[model samples]
Target: MAGVWRQELSSLQAGTQNSILIGIIIHSGNPKIFEPTNPRYGFGGERAVWSFTFRDSPDDFINVTVWGSTEYINSCFKSFQVGSVVEIINSKVLSRRPDDSRDMFVPTVTSPLQITVNEGNALIQFHDSEGRAHYQPLLKMPTKTMDSLRSLNYVLQNIEELRDQFIDLLVVVTFIGEVRDIISRDGRSFKCRTFEVADASTEKTISLQLWDNEWIRLSELWEPRKTVLFLADARVGYDNFKKKTIVSIARKTLITENPSVQQALDMRLAIRNRPELSPSDPYSLPSPKNITNVMTVQQITQKLNAGSTGTDERVQFFAILYASITELNLDSKDANLLLTKCALCKRMVQKDRDSCMNLDCPSGNGSREPYNLVTFNVKLNLKDDTGYLVGCRLIGKAAEQIFGCTATEFQTMKAEQRMELKWKFLLSKFDVRMQVLGPTASITRAIYNILHMSRFETAEDISFDDIIDPMRNH
Candidate 1:
């Protein structure tokens, strides 16, 4: 390392030799193993490869790729995570080609040249010397300037004009959905997670899908409403199933969470006054405009059974269920009907404690007090003429809206008052808006979440028999 001259990424040229480059890893991808096409290539064995994005300055970042044995690549991948400052010694610098297949997955960077590190010719290790702290802060700096950023409201308003185009966005994380395993038709499997983000310009939120394993793992650290993301070159497209424009992490996209930019600071300040939702409930209630889809009990069952994602139907749809609550479980003595969860970690907490005790949570790391949110986790049985759906969830804010009271208010009520409130829902037919999460490997039963519910009157002239008769006749 002594013989190598230190080189900044902006000064890196294709012919540079015996140079050292220092940067913080901003995006770490999962390691992949590939078999050599020819018998002479890689000695007919599988070779391991890993790729990541690193930056040393505000406007200078490059894609760094490592090629070696499976053990070597895996070890390197595990050794350094996204925020680690690394010193690369003697890495081969080469100009990026337009037709390079590896470029399809690598994020577009400010630097035109790419760093390639092989086992023998190059080395990448953690920077342990003085001034390494300077590189670490670069991890949160936006790759693109604020001038290029677009508001979520603008993108939504002009989605038709900008379809299939990529744009930079600065948004606050509003929701993070569950991570799921996906298997393609070709038998390859990977992980994906969907989350929603919003900006100050709009109250509407947009969902973005994370397909990279590294990003999916990193998203676990993102806190709803508190995390700010600066997504560079995020692809915008229309979701046919949901009938809305959506954002996704594309090959050209580089995400910097909690970016140290003025836009990020302003976006966080804009959202600071908004009331917080339960961390356990990431999916919000569908607006009246989106709750137009109508589905019967049998149709919902058929949709779950015909799902292509194994037993799970990963796509969520909102539908109107004109059913009555058969079971409310209000009179039961079970202790779990109401759940107390830590807002930061989203883990269940003891009913007696006000703070989170989860040792793994960052906010609960003894530096600050963790916030707790009391939520209703009651289950209800719903039924119509076609069939019955059991164990449907009525949780968090949605449950409070339907029950006409807060969890704290309900806690103070007597058993007689609780039964009276339960009867109000049980005896009356209601129009219900629900989100459906079909069964998966981890969850054996389909999850039905009642988003909104309102009582129906006989004078309204809507009848369940009238709705079912047409389907039965057809």
Candidate 2:
């Protein structure tokens, strides 16, 4: 006699009966058919069970099982797929429990509660008179404002406090490692991709798994140090192998790149303040010794424009400093600029931390006394009569040589005093010779590596006029 109860997926509980549910089908598994063994059990002759996942919010989802006659399931529900909006009437909720039977072939739903639909008692609607399936608009999905989003620090610290609950939460984290492909241990055809992600709130990193098609679509966009926001509703579980809290992506999970969030801005600043490279790293420029294979600024520009420059190509050239050092803000007073490295591995080691976890080193041991490395990562504008190169990163040995001191010494000088000195020293000079390496192929922007630097000898210096002229003799 009572009207049908309308409820959201999040409000549903075990033992609920005579309820009507409306949601978008986020996932649908293949139907499993069961045949009757005898006349006594052949009430419907043959029946089918279909598992479906529905969600009303980006972070909330419910697993449901639809049971009906084989013909009804095959003809009516076979066309249903992900993203289709459906309404179900007269469904009963049951507490989902881990099945101990090893005969189950598919992944069992582990939600605290699940909805079940039986023949004659349930009705399904997936289409309109136009014969087109209906879908819920993305704008209708529940979302939280930036201010309402929970901090990753709280989630990582209090994962145990919120485990096994049905509430949804959002975390802003950054991806910090490579995505690696994984195959099932059973040597079956199963495959997936896993990556390490972290947040500025803590140094701890977690493993994020992307299965099937999700991996194929998202893996290409993944890069180290990229910030991402994750909306999670599933239970937080501990990973025994990784020894960290593992966050699984469900049908309701939403991963996005929204850098406007305050948390993302803070993480980006922290990453930039601390350089990833060390002094002893091979990528860092070596001290300038011999200069050879010289080329003009015009020639270098032509090579880059023509896409003929190889990533490993090295060439020497002369250019005038176009911008003032002060304007570039190369002398920032941020303390994170001063970083320490492991003596053995040549990898970065936190100031307060004692050991290196780099798998490449034999002595992955942390040291109380880490070798301090000065970082000089800054862009300098260089120009000659023929062409100009902007945002050329002057780092390591080349930067030290030009700055006239190590990073430690430069840090001690007054910011104002140093700026004045650098201006006079650089402005007074015109013939600046530099050996630059080719830009990385992956990056679209023009960024060259400053391998070497020196002042040109007046006698050996070729005039810009001669360098720019096509017929000028060397």
> After superposition on all CA atoms, what RMSD does each candidate show versus the true structure?
17.2, 20.5
What are the lDDT scores of the predictions, listed in order?
0.78, 0.52
| Each candidate's clash count | 0, 2
Pairs in clash, predicted candidate 2: 354-366, 355-366
lDDT string for model 2 (4-36, tens) is: 887767777887777777767655555667786
Model 1 is weakest, by summed lDDT over 10 consecutive residues, at 465-474
lDDT for 34 in candidate 2 is 74
lDDT of 1 by residue, 1-474 (tens): 568999999888998999999889998877889886766544546789999998999889999989888888999998888888989999999999878876656788888899899987799998998989888778888887889988888888898888888899899987776565454323356777877788899877777778877788788888767899999889887877578766678867889989887777888999877754322324544333235556768777866776636643364555788777789887678799888876656678776765566667644455556566678988889887679989998887778878889998988889999988888878577888888887776677788988778875652465544554212312
Model 2 lDDT-worst window of ten: 278-287
Q: What are the models' TM-scores? A: 0.60, 0.35
Best by TM-score: 1
Model 2: how far residue 448 lies from native, Å: 23
